[model samples]
Target: YSIFMCLLMSCISGIGRATALALARCGANVTAVTRTQTDLDSLVQECPSISPVCVDLADWDATDAALQNIGTIDLLVNNAARTSLQPFLEVTQDQFDQTFSVNVKSVLHVSQIVARGMKARGSGGSIVNVSSQASQCALRDHAVYCASKGAVDTLTKVMALELGPFQIRVNAVNPTVVMTEMGHLAWSDPEKSKKMTSRIPLGRFAEVEDVVNTILFLLSDKSNMINGITLPVDGGFLAC
Candidate 1:
């Protein structure tokens, strides 16, 4: 039973934690990455099978060092994104930069680093970038967040095309609002939750399992032919 190093940029909570547990359940030795050592420690206990690594994905040197420690990765999940919800007029330069730095640049750094090892071994791998349904549809007060994810969706296609020759498949999973710890905080108010749920044709936010199943499919050989596509696990949010 050979181990697969699952490169996860998001660590302790939210979708990242779900992804870590999902990969571990599938028998992969997950190398979870995060900014805070405290968060990493929590993750280590949350998903005991996963090996947590503390690294600021936005920092080039730190990310590079973290990847070096992993040596080789069988699959890279670019699931690190920061969302800033504000009206277009109220957006700041710092917000724009931070969103791009994490959502876009960090994906580049991790993918490039992991691809080298995957390519050198002549045994290709898979990359699953976590995009947002906002990339496919418009929402109020999500300009910067949308743009950042839009870039991720585009980057997924580009990587798929470029890495195809090496047999490495790249795909994006665009999920709608997931019911995580963060979701409770974000949509705590009943009015907001109800309004948001009504927008989805399914009348509910996505569950951790919804996105996790889709991610596992993309990572597995089951989706070998499915490349360069943004599979929206949005529960009919994009349809309506």
Candidate 2:
């Protein structure tokens, strides 16, 4: 079976990179849409299954045009986002707009473009939006990031509700701090890391494979009846 997976990930970062590479290794054709080609240099060379498309998700027309002719998409991961670490009072208008544009707007726009294909062709598909626990729990300086992910969770439900008739499944994966380069950089501080990990029963951050495996499952036929739910891969953090 031909599997077309679209990963509109967070600027070629940990979860996106790991998921794309894993999918490629599994022999799935991947279309990785990024805002810049510079971030995808090594990834493209390493994975022959990935076809990189640099389209600014902040621009609606550009996103539509870029993904329009990508053929049928059987799986879609709306991992697009721009995180801004600023206090409530310190967040700027530009930062808020840019964050929402990439985080929330892009997720909706890109899903629409891909879902049309899945719907028109009468092929059932799965869409997994990469979300976070921050959507449910507020972080110190993640006011905007948390809000955007919350929006994603809501969107997942709406998509699941409307697309169920067409055999389309929509869901979200909310993971805890993952140990990617970016994750390590952000949580490298011992005090900060401990503070966060202490809250998680797993007592540590997640590896990239943890989230990737979840995404792969959600996209496969194994999850045929699962829809409109936010699955947390936080190593039991959310359970606490």
Distance from true location, Cα of 106 in model 2, Å: 0.6
Model 2 TM-score relative to the real fold? 0.95
For candidate 1, lDDT tens digit of each residue in 23-108?
Answer: 77777877777777787788787777777777778888877776686766878888887878999999999999988999999998
Per-residue accuracy of model 2 over 190-213 as CA lDDT, tens digit each: 998999999998789999989989
Q: Give the TM-score of candidate 1.
A: 0.93
Alpha-carbon shift of residue 165 in model 2 (angstroms) = 0.6
User: Could you list the CA RMSD of all candidates, in the order they appear?
Assistant: 1.9, 1.5
Give TM per candidate. 0.93, 0.95
Candidate 2 lDDT (Cα, 0 to 1) = 0.84
